[model samples]
Target: MSDSGPSTPPSPDEKPAKVQFNDNFAGKLILPTEEEIQNDPYRRRASSRRVSRRMSKALAIADILEQERQYVIGDIIDLDTIVEADDIEEATTRTRRFSSVVAASRKSQASTKDWRELEEAGDESSGEDEDYLIEWEGPEDPKNPYNWSKLYRFFCLFTVSMQGFCVAFYSSSYTAGIPGMMAEFGITNRTITVLGVSAYLFGMGVAPLILAPLSEMYGRRIVYIIGMASFTIFIIPACVAKNIQTIIIIRFLGAVSGSVGISNAPGTIADIYQSADERSKAFAVFAITAMNGPPLGTIIGGVLFRYLGWRSINYFSLIAAGIFFVAGFFVAETYGPHILREKARHRRLTTGDDKYFSRFDFPPATSLATLLRRNFKRPLKMLFTEAICLAWALYLSVIYALLYMSFIAYPVVFMGLRGWEPQIAGLGFVGILIGTSAGVATDPLSRWGVRRHKVDPETGKIPPEALIWFACVGAVLASIGLWIFAWTCDPGIVKPWVFCILAGIPYGLGTTVVFTNGWNYLLSSYSIYAASAMAGNAISRSFLGGILPLFAPKMYSNLSPAIASTILATLATALMPIPFIFYFWGKHFRERSPMLLALAAQSGI
Candidate 1:
């Protein structure tokens, strides 16, 4: 780093010379200006993922390079000699690399004017019209979502959790009022009544493909606002629907709008929590509601149906939607680009400087199309081609579908065979609720177990495999729980109905842990592309959840109840080895993907 001894340092009045910006250097904390992203085709629409979404995992690696033990303080980087590094280790290597740039950046940051100070002097009269990069003043910058007050962040998470729960709850709760609706519509066919649930699931699956890109374009809060508003407007039609067609169609539309919570919450959670470990605990709350919402909604819906009618479910949804609708307004924008744009806009207005620009803006025509295509294609590509994706998709699909199928199976066992009241039959899923809660309660322990693994040398944090242990254990627990429910729920067996009901505990716990860790594993592995992978999985899971339940009635009617339950337990068992397969080979598989290596290289260090 040293050349020609006895060199004099540049004076404060002499501005630093401009160097060419590297669009591919996404791993660096320092980003290119909004103009750079917009003008360069390669950088447009890519910063949100490469810069913001990938921040937490990227920082874990970046911070390792900054440690005092790794570098000498006197080193200075000459940008002209720096070559673009293709991987994290090379990018991070202490000998004349991006790490040197990082050390030099830290050294010079204290001497420069922050974005705010620069903004104040941004008047056109003050100097030449030169574009300046707008960014968080520092790691603790209040403008950054990660630096938000803990209590307020939790509030946002709570709002997000409700969005997920209410949508999921409504989808399942519709099943509770099927009998009453069928009677009023003069419909005797059970298959016809199931259509409403299928339509809603369809909406849930399809909506996210569109919403994911919209969130990027507008920010999380705008999506939340639009979704909640649409949900509220649609609930009235659902409540007033005169026939099955009206109910089915309205519920589908409702699900499309309400899906904001289910599809987009994880990104927001990542935005707020910089540490993967912290995200685990936060996601646990999300997992509890998303996984258990169906059963809880059914319990409440059954009670409402017994007293008021099936129409009350929509009314109930309306009330919940109304409350969250208002709450949505209070939720801050969490998307990194959107927030930076707003800051840039503010600085422009205050200082009347055209040069004040957010580093994440995109040119509307080309960038939007490219982003949309990426949002649509990459996940499917990974799903079909990537081994890690294929296994998790199958395992998650079975576990997810089982939740929906339970809406039908519970009724057949508790009402058709046991003769329990429709209202009372809803209580069967209590074990599911218990299990889901238990999983959340034990998430810390699960994360702790994962963190016990050797830290990754590059990222300086636990690897994606940290989530696999619980998923493996959860797979077994889920299968066992299903087998117990299958045998114990049969009237010919000596086991009590309570035992079948209690079986949900293991299933619920298994489900919560499996799902929570499953997502975390993806997040850990893919980093930026995690959203694309997750959105694709949501579609498949929703399709199965909706379609599989259509056969529940026939399954119970044709086969013995125990046998039907055993079939489900068997599916769970088949997938039991999936987590184990992943735990061992996940890293290897992840390593093979060129994009993953790029992500690790760019974000790791």
Candidate 2:
């Protein structure tokens, strides 16, 4: 009382300074602004200011009861904390509003960048050809091949995959037409069959060197459309050819068109997916399309050959080629350097700035010699020097040869031994269909393995070697199929048709692994020359495919089905481990090999 002195009703200047707390705070609160009021050791005073009565009472009891009373900052007993309701309705409302604002801001930012880059990426030049040829910036650039609009890109993907299907189908379907072709051309069965299969392979092998490089120099869409169109046009001659050699020439030319599938399709898929994991899945899809065509075409060909005549096969191909042509018109170009170079051209035109050209742009009036040098040397260089590329190509070639052999041998086996009709014998090829399905069925397991394991820098997430297990399993099945066809092939016991089905297990599955793994490893190691590498591979594989089938009949005649199959199976068994070896060791080999070193030097890797 003496010191307080009736609180000296402070002067106007000294009146209790207003204590400002945060906004939305209420009166009678001990605000931080007023030192005197904040530090005042006064007992609690009642005021008109409202408080949660429950908290106030609890605080009072807590102080008086002195149950080890300890002071605490913040509301020691918050009414909100004690509340029974799960929702902090006010806080939740505020938080949600804040989050919405943040999310919108982020979306706006991303959208701004996405649109800017996409518009910039799409700008292609027409006048100056210098900007038309250059290496792409990278995967992140909107101009990158993988960054294309999904619809346009998917169209290309479908076209590439379907091309593989069409080619594979065409190759096998011609087998069904062998007899008719022979009769019409007045040639021996062996010659017609050889031309039918061999011409297709020859096309497969040779077209790529010319076509793949041309496509690279120009654009993938142009080559694909032109190749398929040319192939379709040639089918007319194949359908109506009056002589055997004319049929052979037409078939070879038609195959040249079709060879684009074998050479370019896998590379096209690689171009579309940026990541290795994605490429593997794409390879699987491509593999399915590539592998599925043989049986599917053979079956359809068998039925069509029986009912519609052999000309229907060529006619069917015309329909497919027509569909591909229409689709190609809409396929967006995905070549990386091409897209970037196009962007540079746009920049130059828009700003009158020639300084924006990328280093990858080709100089004006590049010579055909330079182009040929690039096309011929690049893929062959990759094939010869890169262990990864060479191994995979070899493996794929073996598997392809094996698959084609089945096509050539099955007709002879079932028709000659079990006396089955062409249509019924064609059903024997269904074994390959089954084996292919079985191989594809392993995809889920492969995906799971990739998910379960940590990524390996060497072979990527799913080692290409993992694909080999299926090949080995398939090789064994093929061996059994061969054994069955060769041994029990006589009409007396099990039908020859049964042997075809059984043998297909190995042939189909083996080819699946071979094509898929070869494709995967090629892309993983030589991404720069992926298209050319595949094109070259197609050349090698198709050449093998063509050459091997030409001799199939003779080989079977000389060796007997059992002996021929045994030799083939033994070779497959020996080679089956090759994929596995490369899967694990390929990265090291690629890094250490002189061939790879030379390729890297040439490619400027």
Give me the candidate number with maximum TM-score. Answer: 1
Show model 1 residue runs off by greater than 4 Å: 1-131, 137-151, 273-281, 349-352, 364-367, 454-462, 591-605
TM-score on alpha carbons, each prediction: 0.76, 0.67
Give a tens-digit lDDT track for model 1, residues 1-605.
Answer: 00111112347997532223234554354334545656877665453334332332333333332211111110111111111122323432212211112222322432222322332343334342223546688888987988999999999999988988989889889999998998999998888889888889989988988887677667789889999899889989888888889888888899999998887787778678755356656766787787778889989998999889989988998999889889878888877657886887788689975456553444222245655786678777877877777778888988988878888889888888898887898898889888988987886677467646765554333566756688888888888889899888888884478889888999988887788678667644554355566767777888888898888877988898889988988888887888888888877777787666654454442
Candidate lDDT values, in order: 0.69, 0.57
Candidate 1 TM-score, true structure as reference: 0.76
Structure candidate 1, residue pairs in collision: 88-601
Per-residue lDDT of model 2, residues 451-556, tens digit only: 4533344322333343334444544555555555555554555553455467667667656644543554454343323455565676677777776677788877
Query: How many clashes would you count in candidate 2?
Result: 7
- Predicted structure 1: lDDT: 0.69
